[model samples]
Every structure is written in structure tokens, then in C-alpha cells.
Target: TGDLLPPLVHLGAAAPSGLVRIPNSNPGTPETLLATSFNMHQVTRHKLTLAGASFRVATTPLLTCDDVDFHPTDILVDADGSLLVLDTGGWYKLCCPTSHLWKPDILGGIYRISRKGAPLIEDPRGQELAWRHVPVEELLRRLADPRPAVRHRAADQLVSQSQRTEEWLDDNFATRPPAVRLQLVWILTRVGSDNAVTCLRSLLEDDEPEIVTAALKGLSLLRDRGCLEAARKLLQHPDGAVRRNAAELCGRTADRSAIPDLLAALTRTSDRWEQHALTYALIEIADVSALKQNLTHQSASVRASVAWALQSVAPDQLQAETVLPWLTSETPLLQQTAQLLTAQRQDWETPLADWLQRQLAGGGSVSSSLLAVVQHFGQSEHVQRVVLAAAASDTLAASARAALIRGLGKSGRHPIPQDLTDTVVSLLETSHPELLQALLDWLRASERSAAFNRRIWPKLLAIAQDDHYSATIRLQALALGGEERPVLPKPLFEFVLEHLDAEQSVPEQLAAVAALREGTVSPLQRR
Candidate 1:
């Protein structure tokens, strides 16, 4: 519940999942210039990104830059849990100082930050070990050293002897703890050799989901067909993450072999996003045979997933027989899934048109899924009547009305029908930002539509000039009005001119510049 502090200057590489030493470089005395704030003091508190999470460290400076000449360049964590900071910034010149005071001194110092009573480190660098001629086994043991510097250096040495490393891993990988094994897994995957793949395959059933998922991720890189059995078994894993990683691996491998477990998992899995991952695996396999055959499977969930898969990856091959059951099924989720499929294929026009008519006649409510698909059906007399009626309804929800407007614009089916012109232009009368944005987006796409006639210009100009609205709304209005670079009448010219001085947002200024790019003033006004 405190103010968000600005970032520390010149932060170093991320540490191994804890607070590590780092520097605040170019500590030019506190000042602001050109909107850049240089507020480095001999003081600080900050958050750092470590392993994809932000951690706020002690809200006070651990060690202040007591001397202006001391700017730390790097920080290292010793095995004893002390931080060794390298202050090499003393020798370099940091320009752009607002104070006009600068110092250039060739002086540097190494400073250590440590707890008052922490134990002393033993073999911090394994100095007593045989580094000049260390054995591979010794290096492997050091991979789990309490010090990151020690572990990484040992890993580098071990990996250099690839032949012996792989042989040792084959016999001894399981003896290590999860943390050490995780490191080994990443190193093995990076090598990705024949023996490495063979070793990784055995860990598919590791007690740790992380270990199994990491193994699958590594195996997936090679699209190794040998792991299909492992992948198939893991598809039914209880952990959603493991299941997802396994599903991705299965998809990448694409074995012609059937994965009935994949369909079974789809029936049982409750997470919608995870179901999508499983369904994606089916799509990648694109087993035209399995997808079509499974449409008759007794499990409603499997049938829904199968029908959706065929429609997604093999739409033309998706027979009406395959999708019809779910489209007309009493199960609401299944029917909605099928209805969504209609938005994808032009051949499914009848279902879409009939649904639009129902939305108009059945009252104004639209299901979230159904609303997403309706805009794709806006063309021809069958669509225009219902879509226009929805757009013209002041009582209909704003989101539904906005969607209908989007549909009409996408029809790209030209020549605004004279009868529907009023309803189409009527879209501009609403002040709701979503509806206005949808209309402008349509206008941007259909620049030559007769709907953008003399009547549309004034409303477009007013929306662009209004400051009471948000920047996004104003930006869209400017986009439609600016698209043609029209020689605007004087009042219309002033309308677009007012936006030129929008100092804060670069986008608003750019919009104004784009509107004025090539056009010139008319002679009638020039006189």
C-alpha cells in the first residue's frame, strides 16, 4: 500500500530465486529532463523480477553509494550467503547530468554485504577440489553446490565432457534431489542428443509433475515418436499442467496411432482451457477418421470436442452429420460449441441466418457465445433485416448492438441497400463508445461504402473533436474522418486541427499529422 517506486538504473542479470546484489548506475544528481526522472540517491528500496515473480526486498538501502565514485557493476552470491558487489562504474563518464556537476575517477572497490552472524563459506569455489583436472563425477556433485556461482561453473565444466556426462546421467540421475535433477534435465534437453532423449523418456513418470512436464517439453522439441506411449499415459495425469504439456507433446509428435485416452480425458477434464489444449492435440493429429467416428461416441463432452476439432482443422471434411447432433442437442454447452462453429464456414450460412432471425424475434438477449458468431452472418436481405433491427434498437444492450454493427460492416457486401441506409447511418446517433468504435472500425475497412456520405461526415467530425470522451474513442473518430484525406470544409478543417496540440499522447499527435499530411487549403478559404 505504498507508492510504486521507479526502476533502479542499469539493473543486472536476474539472480537464483532470491535477493542478490545489484547496482544503481549513472547516479547523476536527482533531476528531471525531457520527461526522464533521474532520482538516484545514496538511498533505495525496490522490486525485482525473479523466476517470473516480483519480490519487494527490504524497503531501505542495504548499502548506499556513500562515495559518488562508487557505482556497482555486478553482484555475486557467495556460498556463505554473502553478496560480493563489483563497483567498476568509477572509471566511466555518465553524461546528461541536469546538475552540470560530473566526476570522472579511475577508482573501484569490492564491497561485501553479509548477515552479522552467518556461518563462513567452505569451498565457495571448490578451491580445494581438483579444478585443473577435476573428474566428471566431482563436477556433477558440485552442480548442487549451495552457491550459484559454484553450481554454474561446475555445470559448465561437466557439460564440456558431453560423452561422459550423458553416461553418468544414465546411471546416476535419479539419486539427485528434485532441484539438482531439474537443472540436469534442462542441460540434457539443451544437448538433445540420442542418448539424452533416451534418458529423458524414462522420467515421464517422475513423482514430481514439474520433472515430468519438463521431460515432456524437452521430448516435444525432437517430436520423438518413441515417447508416444509415455505421452499417451501422461495425457490422463491429474495435474492440469502435466496434462497440457503432455497434450502439446502428443500434438507435435502426430503419431497415426489412435489416442482414445485423449478423448476419454476430454470427457473427464473440467478445466475449459485445458479441454482446449486436449482438443488442440486432436486438431494437430487431424485424424479425419477418428474425429468423424467419435461424433457418435456416447459421451456428450467427447462428441462436442470431436465435432469442434473436425470443424477447426478439417472444416470441409466436417460433414453435417458430424456436427448436427451437437448443434441441435439439448445440452446447452454442446449446442453453443456447434453454433460457434458456424462463424468459421461459409457453407453453414443457413444455421447462422436462422439464428439471427431468432435473436430478433425471440427478444433482445444474446448469449455471449452466440453474440460472438452473429457478426459473421451480416450480409444479404436475410441478414440485414434482423441485424439492422438489432442495431436500431435503443433498448437492446449496447454490446449486442455494437456486435450487429460490426457484422453489417464486415459483410463487405457493397452498395448500402437504399432501404437499410437510414438504419446503417443510424449507427452514428449512439454515444456508447463500443458501438461508435465498431462503426468507425467498419468505416475504416469499408472506405468507399455509400454509407460514408455527406450525412456521415458531420457526426464523424464531432466525435473526433469532443474532448469529454476518452483518447481511444477520439482516436477512432479521427481514424475514420482522416482515412480519405478528404478536403474538409472550413469548420470540418478546424475540427481536425484542434487535435494537433495533443501534447501528451503520441498517438493523438500522430493522428492529427496523418490527417493533415498531403491535403491543402481550398482557394475559397485562402482568399
Candidate 2:
């Protein structure tokens, strides 16, 4: 009853419609929907790179609303994979007032499409079986059912019996297939009882590494101190997956004793996946005193990792003097991470501009991230010089040049220096779109001066007069030329006013409107 609005004369949907193509009157309104499905992945394999994801691709779609105005508000999948579609794009005016001027509410359809040759599935909601009173053995067998709804129902009932769950695990867990065994560990982990924890501890000795890794993952979430020793032992497991899971478990438990093993693992593997887990564990534990003691390690990579972990633990203790060795190093990760760490100190902003200038003067290799640091935080006379130097260079990359100019535009803390006016004017010949846009943004941000009128005005007038440039750029040029000047250039106002006709494109006309709003007009010059 709350959805009401006065009648809209320009309703985009046509009446007498089951489904019709919606008109463009209300364009670009996004639709939101609800969906029903569970994670369909089996627990048997550990190689699925996207952990805890439930997405699957089917070779053929169950139904498609192609060539129709079809937007469904909700979708449901039945036990046999049949799809129920609720299409409401036709007559349901989402929030339009419940008006009597015209009725369009009775217009959507509910559709169901089923697989042709598949066997029928009985709905569990029918409750033919007394689920709680069902025999324990039958419930265990149903855990292997093909339908997710059935398997979930069985687990929901079996989770209530801790003694029975433990007894079944001691007697029959090994003989079941790996998939079923993994499922038992998952179900017990949900109970959060003594028997559940004990059952998980027993499986840590299982012969299969994947089974052991799965147990480690569950225990990590439980975060029991009793399993800390058990998790610590797998830190050097021959399998990388086991090591990763073990590192994560130690991190979650916050065991101070596991720091040594975590460090050893970090220095041993060059694999980024292993490095990520080990680094995450160290940061989670956050023992800065211990992390600092490892700085003397012989491997530069290990030292760099420790330095990063240390700074992350205590951001205030960072000294750029100690870190410059890494910021200037050949190792890409160390240099990039060091840039992020130094950028935290806003007092160091001018120093960043100095560093860039020194690099430029020496003709040394400049990392892209270091350049970004200078551009993002730097706002000084040195920054103006850096932008001017980068702009005129033919050897510098286009993106690097653009970043410097953008930094100048973003410098609100410090005044835009007048020294850059000539360099900004010389950019008139830049053919790169990104550099040209950055220059325009800088011009718009800078405070106008006498130098702006004498140097920048001429180039802007040329751009406005030359037809080679797009109309949008030309109109922008015309607007920028007279924006701060008390009197609009006679030639500039005359040319634009003459072309304000139906023959110009809509964008040109709109840009002309913005220019007219900024510039002054003389009563004597009106024609």
C-alpha cells in the first residue's frame, strides 16, 4: 500500500502487455534480484584454487528469456535442477504509487522449466520421513545423496548426536571414501563441543594429506590452544598446502612459540602462495620484538619481508633512512612495499619530490611506484620543477608524465607555483589524450596570473579557432580563455555566438552553455 505516486503520463511500459520491450524514457535503471542455491563443490579435492567458492558452469541453460523484456526479481532451483523464474519487468511498477488512473499490476508470470530425461525428485518439505526419528545408519547414507537439499537435511539431523558422531568416526571413518570422511569432519566442526574437538584431533593422524589439511582448516576456525602443538608440527610438511593451512592455524591461535617456525618457512620458499600465508600469519600474531630480531638474516628477500612486517606492526616507528636501501634496491617487491610504507608520513612529502629530482639528475632508474608517491603527496616548488622536467622529456613514458601533472592539480595544501606556466603552455602540441586531459585539469586548478594571460591565452585562442580539434575541447578552450579575464576576448565571444545554431551537435551546444556562463558579455557588442 505504501508504493504510491501520482500518475506518470509518460509511463515507459505499454498496457495490454504480457511482455513488451520497455521504452527508453526511464533509461539505465538497474535491477536487483534474489537467488536460491548452496555451494555445490565437493570436499574431496583440495586443488580448487578459489577456496570456499560455489560457482559452477552448466553446458546448457535451463531457460533463456532471449528477445523478450525479461527481468526476473527472484530465481529458485528445485531438487532436480529445474529452474523457477519470476519475471516482473512487464507490469510491476516497482515503487510507483498504487494509482487508479491505469491498472498495470496484474501482469507478471511464474515459469518453471525441467530437465527432459532426468528422474523426478521428491521434495523434502513433504516430511514423509520422521527426520529426527530416522535410523542413524540411514541418515549417514543420505549424506552421500546427489541433491544438496537432501545431504544438508541429513547433516542437520546428525549434528545433534555427539556420542554417536564420535563412535561412528572411531569405527568407520577410514573405510568411507575420502569425500565422505571430509564431510564428517566438517559436520563435527559445527557442533563446538568436547566430543567434536576430540574427533577433529584424532583425524590429525590420518594417512591422507588432503584429509589432514581439511582437519587443519576446520581446527583453525575453532582456534583451540590445545591444537597449537599439533598445527605447529605441520609447518614443515612436505606438501605446500599442508604448510599453508598450518601457518594459518598458528596465526589464528596466536601462539607466540610458533614465530620461529613461521620465519623458517618464509625464508625457505620462493613460491608466492606460501609466502602470502606465512606473511599473513606473522602479521596476525604481531610480535614486533621478535620480528625485529630477524633483520640480520642473510637473504635480502627475507630481510625485506621482515622489514615490511615490522613496519606494518608499528607504523610510527618507520625511519626512511633505514628503508631507503630497500626503496632504492633492484628487488621489485621490496621497492614497491617501501614506497607504501614511506607515504604514511605526510611530513616527508617534500623529501619525496627531492628524491625524484635527484633520480632525474643522476639519470638513475625510477620505479613507477616511487613516481606515484612523489605525485600523490608532493606539493612544493620542487614538485613544480619535477612536473616541468617530466613534461618536456621525450624519453619519459606517457603515463609517468601524466601522473606528475595530475599531482600538480591535486596539490591543494600548497599554492600552485607560477614557475610552471611556460611548461604548461608548451604542452599545446602534446598528442597523447591522457597528457592533454591532465594539462587541462591543471589549468583549471591553477590561480590565474598576468603570465596566464600573456602566454596561455594565445594557445587557448588558437585551439578554439582551429577546427582540427574536437568541438568539446574547443569549447573548453574558449571557456578557459576568458574565465578569469574581466573582458571576454572579442574574437572568442564573436566566433562562438555566431555558431550557436541547430547545425552544431548537442554536446557542442552544452559546452557552449558552460562557456557562456563563465565569460562576460558586452551590451555594446550584442548583435
Candidate 3:
């Protein structure tokens, strides 16, 4: 192994060790051998004789690593007589420094070596085939070649020789194998000429559903608005796959004119996947009114899909009259779906707030759904109601409280009322990490007046210096204090500096540094 040891020991040595004979059927050719040379980064080929083996330093290496750290390990001669050289690569120096143990680089790959004119006995599925000089007719025949490489190359070249090949493809369209015809349709799309669109349109009427689907895909790829009429016709096709592909293509076309056809298709199929495909197409076309019509669908699943589709397009179109009825549905899925849709719509604020007020007044426990409604669309008035619910309901779930806190934070888009601030500040005494984090987030997001900052700064300063609370909560408190200018008092400034100088975890030190920087205090100035 140490036969070719380099003089500098620390840099490592080339350990050329394992050897294997290459099996050859030709008696006339000299016997060949392969071996690994680690540090030199080459698979050293040799000539084998009955007496001994001699190294053959050919102009081209059997395999070589361009990168300096590659370590060649072993060699295998496949049945096809191709050499498969395994590279261990650099592991210890690059990855596992402490262990100093040899391990192969996870990213390393095998190197294949074969002599000129060597017949590859393995499956020729992806093997490269020459196609340049082959006649257009000959290339068409190669489309049926078992190897994908041959088929793909032939299709590419045939499309490049466009005029004659297109005519031949059109003439032989009915007589050719379905697979070959499909490949032709794909080729035409790549050609993307006006004639290709005509060819794809014709294939849309083919008897084979698979061929029609492929043709639809090709037409969609062309993305020509002219193809929209043909795609719209397939929406009525008996085959679900064809209709699905056609609907998807119409969406990709993004023609508002396809809205009526997409809506008509939605009424025909109860198939969830098909309905989903149609709903998405309608959404892409931005037909808000048509989508709102489907909100009244008899099937809850369909209504849910329509609701989800509406979530993206027209949240304003989501009426409380339509969605409130869904919340009362027997199905949980529908109820949850309605809640999500309501949460995303800003216009639902007044109605949803009224519903929550009624629910709380009736002595109902706060639900996450109510909180979601407020979180997304809550006003300052809605924020006060949520704070009252949180205070009154001692039995409130942690998740519900968290949701309420998030809603309160989101409501800070408007000026926070003094009552809301006092309510939030009193919760800090609970020292609950989630609530504290939520309060910090709310303070950061809120537009605090100078007076509000002056009032909150001392309370936040106590949280920042306290060791009883988690580093995360304390860091958040520090971050909240940093948001307003001139809020960091002189005492808090020295406390932050001391914390930065103290031996602390990476996160704690980072928090202290950030707080100091945001307060316009530089650590370098102290030096």
C-alpha cells in the first residue's frame, strides 16, 4: 500500500494496491490489468503476463481526479469489459476532522472506463446514438428504438429537419405506433411553428385518450391563444383525463373567455380531482363571479374546493351569508374550510366580529376559528373584545390564548388603545413564554407613541435582565425595547453591555449585540 510514499509525510502517500485482470475473449490481444493509486489520483492500468505485471503509463489515464483531494479506492471490471473505478475521495480532512478515520466522501461518484470499439453488454436504454446524417425516414424508424436516448435524439433531429419530417409525420399519423405518434406530437410542440399548432389540434381528436392527452399537453406548451377554442371543445370529451388536461391547458392559456366553459365542466363532474382542476382553471382566469356561484354547490367537498379557490381570487366575494351557513354544516371539513376562508377575507370583519360577540355573550368558550377571523380582519374594536374574552375566560385553551394574542398583534395596525396596552402589560406577570413572546411581537409591530414607549420600556428592561425567564423570551423583550428610538435607559444600556461582555451562549450574546446596536450604542466606543 505504501509503495509510492511521498517524502512529505503529512501530505499523505499514494497507496497503489488492489489489482484485477480484465477478461478478454480475443486471444490475439495482450492481457490487461487495472489497479488503484490513491494519492496520485489515477487508476493505473498495467499489462499482465504469465511471468509478472508491468505498469503502462498511457497518455490518457484510465481515470483521473481533477480535484486534489480525491482518493481512488477499488476497481471492478463489468461483464461489458468496462472498468468501474471507485473513488473514496477526501473525507477526514474535509468532514470528520476529530476522528481522523478514513471515510468515503458522500458526494463521490464512480468513473467508467472502456477501450475504443468495446461493445457495451449492459442495457442500452440511455446510450448515445448518432443521428445527424440519418435520413428523415430513417430517423422516424429510430423513434421506436428501445433506448430512450435513440428515440429522443431521432425526435430532436427530425424536428430540426422540419418541412419534410412534418409532412411525413402527418401522412403516416394513423399508421404509426401510438408511442411513436405521441413522440411526434411532442416534437411539433418543440418546433413551435404555426404548422405545429395545426398538427397538435388534429391529434386532439385522435381515438386514443392517451394520444389526445399528450396532444393537449403539447398544445398547452405552445400557449397560443388560438389553441383555446380547440382545448375548450375537449372539456366535453367523455374521457375524464382528456377533459382534465383540456381544463388545465385552458387555465394555462389564461383566457377569460374560457370561464363559461370551465364553469360548465365543473357542473358535469362530481370527481374531486376533476372539480379541483376546473376550479383552479377558473381561478387562474380570475372569474370571481363564476367561482362564487359554485360556493352554493350541494357537495360539501365541492363547496370546500370553491371556498379554497375563492381564498386566492376574491376574498371580498366570500359573503358572510354564504360562509356562515357553512360553519353550521354537519360536516367538520366544511366548517373548518369555511373558517379558513373567512379568516383570509378582510370584508368579513363586521359580520364575523358580530358572530364572535354573540358567541362570547352566550357564554361559549373562545374557539381558534373566532381568533383566526380576528387575526386576519380584526379592527381596534375587535382587539378590545378579544382582550376581554382572554381576561374573562380563565378556562381558555393555551392554543386559543396564543391565537388571541396573535390577533391582538395583528390589530396593532391601528393605534393601540391604552386599555389594550394595560391588559397586555398585566399578562407579563404570568411569565408564560408564548404569551410573553406574543406581547413582544405586538409591541414591536405596534406604532407606540413616545409616552407608550416610556411606560413599557422599564417593564421590558426588567424582563431583559431577568435570568428566571428563558433566553428566547428575554431576547424578545430586548428586541421589543429596541424598536423605538431613545427607549433604552442608561442603566439598561450598561446592563446590555455587561451581558455582551459576559460568557453566554451564541444566541444570548447575539441578542445583546442586536439590542445595543438598535439603541445606537456601539461596543467599540466603550474601548
RMSD of 2: 11.7
- What are the RMSD figures for all models against the true structure? 12.2, 11.7, 16.2
Ranked by TM-score from best down, the candidates are 2, 1, 3
What tens-digit string does per-residue lDDT give for candidate 3 at 1-527?
00122221122355664567765422224557677776677776666432101112332256776776666768986545566877666563433332255555544568787788865545454344554577787887888875555666777788778876656645646677777777877888888877778878888878777678778888887776777888899899877778888988998888888877876776677665567677777777776776787777776666776676776777667678778656546677677676666655566666766666665554435565566555654554664555545643555655556556677677546566665656655666555667677666666676666667656776876887788887656766776654463545666666666667657777778777767666444454455
TM-scores, all candidates, are 0.51, 0.61, 0.49
Best by TM-score: 2
Q: Would you give me the overall lDDT of model 3?
A: 0.66
User: Runs in model 1 with CA error above 4 Å?
Assistant: 1-132, 296-301, 319-340, 354-382, 386-416, 419-527
- What's the distance in Å from true for residue 525, model 2? 8.8
Model 3, residue 317: C-alpha shift (Å): 5.0
Residue pairs of candidate 2 with colliding backbone atoms = 4-97, 5-97
Q: List runs of model 2 lying over 4 Å from the truth.
A: 1-63, 67-69, 73-76, 84-113, 122-126, 130-138, 205-210, 229-244, 264-276, 294-313, 322-328, 342-482, 486-527
Candidate 1 clash pair list: none
Score candidate 1 by TM-score against the native. Answer: 0.51
Candidate 2 CA-lDDT value: 0.63
Please, what's the RMSD in Å of model 1?
12.2
